[model samples]
Target chain A: MSELHLEISKVGIDFPTPKGPFCALQDVNLKISKGEFVSLIGHSGCGKSTVLNIVAGLYQATTGGVMLNGREVNEPGPERAVVFQNHSLLPWLTAYQNIELGVKRVFRGKKTKAEMREWIEHNLELVHMTHAMHKRPDEISGGMKQRVGIARALAMEPEILLMDEPFGALDALTRAHLQDSLMEIQTALGNTVIMITHDVDEAVLLSDRIVMMTNGPSATVGEILDVKLARPRNRLELADDPEYNGYRTAVLRFLYEKQKKVEPIAPKRAEKAAEKDSSKQVA
Target chain B: MSESTTVIPTVSSAKAASKFPTALVSKISPAKLRDIVLGTCLPILGLVFFLLFWHVGAQHIKTSLGTFPGPKEVVTQWNNLVAEQKDEYAREAAFYERQEKRNAEALKEDPNAEIKVREYNGRPTFFNKIQTSLFTVLSGFILATVIAIPMGIVIGLSQSLYRAFNPVIQIFKPVSPLAWLPLITLVVSSVYVSEDPMFSKSFIISMLTVTLCSMWPTMINTAVGVAGVSKDLINVSRVLRLDWLTHVRKIVIPSSIPMMFTGLRLSLGIAWMVLIAAEMLAQNPGLGKFVWDEFQNGSSDSLGRICVAVLTIGVIGFGLDRTLLAIQGYVNWDKSAVVR
Candidate 1:
């Protein structure tokens, strides 16, 4: 566990806009050991997901680069599997076929067809999605679709897993359920993972290290808080625990007090925020 | 939640709970009664109204040949046409039997005698003309699909190639089959040379004209579909490290099938229309030709026969469209797609 499994050294990404080149992220540095779970949390448009995409090799970094297991990632490969924010499973394929597509392509030389089927079932079982393996994405709910997305990513036996807001679109109870299952799956598999999220509780509950990002147009890592909570932590216990509250408070402070100045793009949102600030002062 | 209002299940459970609504509907006799009445009675009433108006209008109309044929006259002509086809078949069978008997007799009397079978040359019936028209249109449609689909895929995948061919497509798309018929006829006549041709020249002319006019819709639709593939799906393909062939096969084709089928349906419509026009103008042996001949015949029953041909053409066009829609429903993975 002491050895680094993945490194993002001073990576920067720039997208061309009509006016000029917009720098979404700059000089972002992250390092993870073999079994670490890290979360990048910030406001929307903070380039947290941009950083994850760079690490996944889906987008090329303008300056620095990502290295996985001592190899520079120049292109996306099955070894670095990604669970996209929208659960990007092909709508035409059932859940089983979607995961099997990636597994068959990546592990063709090493495993027989029957073994691959067993591996796919095993991953689905990990995400508690074995019951709905034959359902198409359209036929299932948003949470089930995201679970299948995770199953597909893990079925490849990837060296590193990248997930972008996997449960951000679900309801509160379902999100919590998925988060718990995710933690259980992570503990059993022990794969290095980097997830992007904006939720504070999700960051604290699932990550070993929460890497807080500053807001963009030039976003970078602002703080790294190490989570020392014991393994297999209970959510209900942590909700009332003083030590967990301290960790939660620290993340909230970084997001609210330290980085409270939100640049609203829409006038309606800006008006609403102003009203919210006045209400808070009144309370 | 209120007592009367049921709690909405979560999304995952929603799938398992989908059957509840249908089950509830089935249990309600009034709901089922309303469904049947609305579905069946309304369309039948509209059709009946159309026939009544058509019959009334036909009585007042007068033409150079005679009074325009009404529904009753069209039925009479249809029966006459069916009887003519049966009589023609009997004549053909008798002619073949007589030829065989004479050839056998000649061979028995003289062992070295030559035996030659001549074809029966009876006028094609209305049903035979319909068969010819159907055969010609399907062949043209299949040929267009074979060429247009591959070409559309290539052009869609390459931006530079799309730009190069876009102007040509825009220019040629509006040209009618009538405008190309003369040029195609001349070219086919000068180019296609065989001592024993497999197809008649007039048939070739009609088929080629249908192919030319109908291929555009499919090509344009396919190009648009390929270009419009969702960005998230492309990202998924990249993440899985799918090769070019696999990406196209698994992702591009399935994703674009709905749009591709839409194009094919439009092309089929155009093919059917163009084949009828080509058959009429080129004097080919089909329904269009049958109508043209009836117009020239100018007998007392000529207008009624033309009415029968027109009705048959409309019925056949509707059947073809329904067939294509059935195929689209079966092949598309999205089972919830409403074909109508």
Candidate 2:
């Protein structure tokens, strides 16, 4: 097997809050193999987005490191392209122009205007967004805008694509539709992908492997499940499948287990506190 | 998903259907008539009530000016002005004809005559006042726009300078145009230094005052607009490695235009208001000056002519606002960019 295309090592992130430090993620380590689809699933605010942003170089790791194809990640570079949850498109640009801007920037000096247009058209068509090429962000539906964002990201032909809950803001039906479209596109292109999602069903359906994070303030990798589902999964058909239930149950259990511990009012292990007090008294 | 994704292709179709709003409105079996009536009733009712009160004020309650002429009086004054305009036209024709005959003989002797013909149409017609006011308003507006937009962009782009200049702007923004008129008059008298004595002092005063008053809103709005562009868009510029000029062209200006237009609209409305007030105080030959002149003359139905001036002001103001709005809609191109 080819070496992993993107590796995140010993990563931890702390954010400043008014009251105190907020530990969003802790001791996070992962490697995404070439041509593999990896989905990081956790409860909302499990710092899944923080981890994705770190990989995208939008945010830096406090202590650990991010490496892409054996190079150290310093800041945002064209090798990693991100599609944000909100589409993050320039509201002023047409879909065609937005994609063209991405392609022209990444493939600078390699393509002419006609060639760039062809590249934009190819990716737009891949996401079935050819008709919306001339449409502005506001002129299109939320789903359509997300498709344009996806097209723009894919059009860049980056080494690893980092999606920060790309479909989290959509309706269930639109989410499912985009999931299918994403699967189709991923199969054709086969680039390394690290997607951040809170939806368990989304994780099961889209990923070769799911990296589930424990809930914060010091979140860790709770479980990593291998989804052995076959290719070209029908979203509706797979949801009803017995095997789908097995994967869903496993993720659900891990989430609920840490969710019980990770809440603010939850009782801690009584012995640990008692032991801490006794040790303090002896000291 | 029942091909909900197909909606992306027909966005323009949706937009076109949305333009009328009555069709899909009915398709949804909406209570659209109720909505239209509900939406329109208040403004319509407000207009009716306004006219009614105004009618009563002009007909019954005699102000210090004596029975402020109602809408009927206004129509009459308008017609009288129209007749006076026609009579003036005849007089102008006679003056031109007499002068042309004299010039023709002179020109027959010297074909390349450098003759400056003057027809002194004293109490030059009401139309002339409108033309004067329009020219002053247009000239001031163009000059303000030429200076304001680039300045606004520059101030808006920089954080520290924006903070530094804000205090001075705040100090001056609310100061009345009337206050600036005396100062501008003094400056222009000394510094303008043009020997064109035929150039009306009132015209220069109104223009200078309008330029000062109207330029602020555009500056403030453009700056705020540029500053308010999404951080995400800024990050995109960084990643794309676009230079400073590209960043401004592709990101900043387009995002700021709607706000800039809002400023322009506001500035224009203020400019007209200021120009009128300046004219009123200074006896500039515009609508406001016309009103002041009539008030001073106190002619029979002088107040009626004042009403005429007021009505003309409202109509002209409305026309100017709509024209700016039309230009805004034209340049925006992306219909979604409109505020409402």
Candidate with maximal lDDT: 1
Give the CAPRI class of candidate 2.
Answer: incorrect
**Lowest lDDT 10-mer window, candidate 2 chain B?**
B1-10
Candidate 2 C-alpha error for residue B11, in Å? 42
Best by DockQ: 1
State the weakest 10-residue window (summed lDDT) of model 2 chain A: A266-275
With candidate 2 superimposed using the best TM-score fit, by how many Å does residue B148's alpha carbon deviate from the native?
Answer: 4.1
Clashing residue pairs in candidate 2, if any? none
Q: What stretches of model 1 exceed 4 Å from their correct place? A: A266-283, B1-35, B100-119
Kindly list the per-residue Cα lDDT of model 1 for residues B1-340, writing each as its tens digit.
Answer: 1321242446644444445563554355887879889999999999999899989999999988778888999999999999999999999999999999999999999989998989999998999999999999998898998988888887887767889998998898889999999998999899987999999888899999989998988898898788777777877888898988988888888888888899999999999999988998888899989988988889999999988988899999999989999999998999998876
The 0-to-1 C-alpha lDDT of every candidate, in the order given, reads 0.87, 0.81
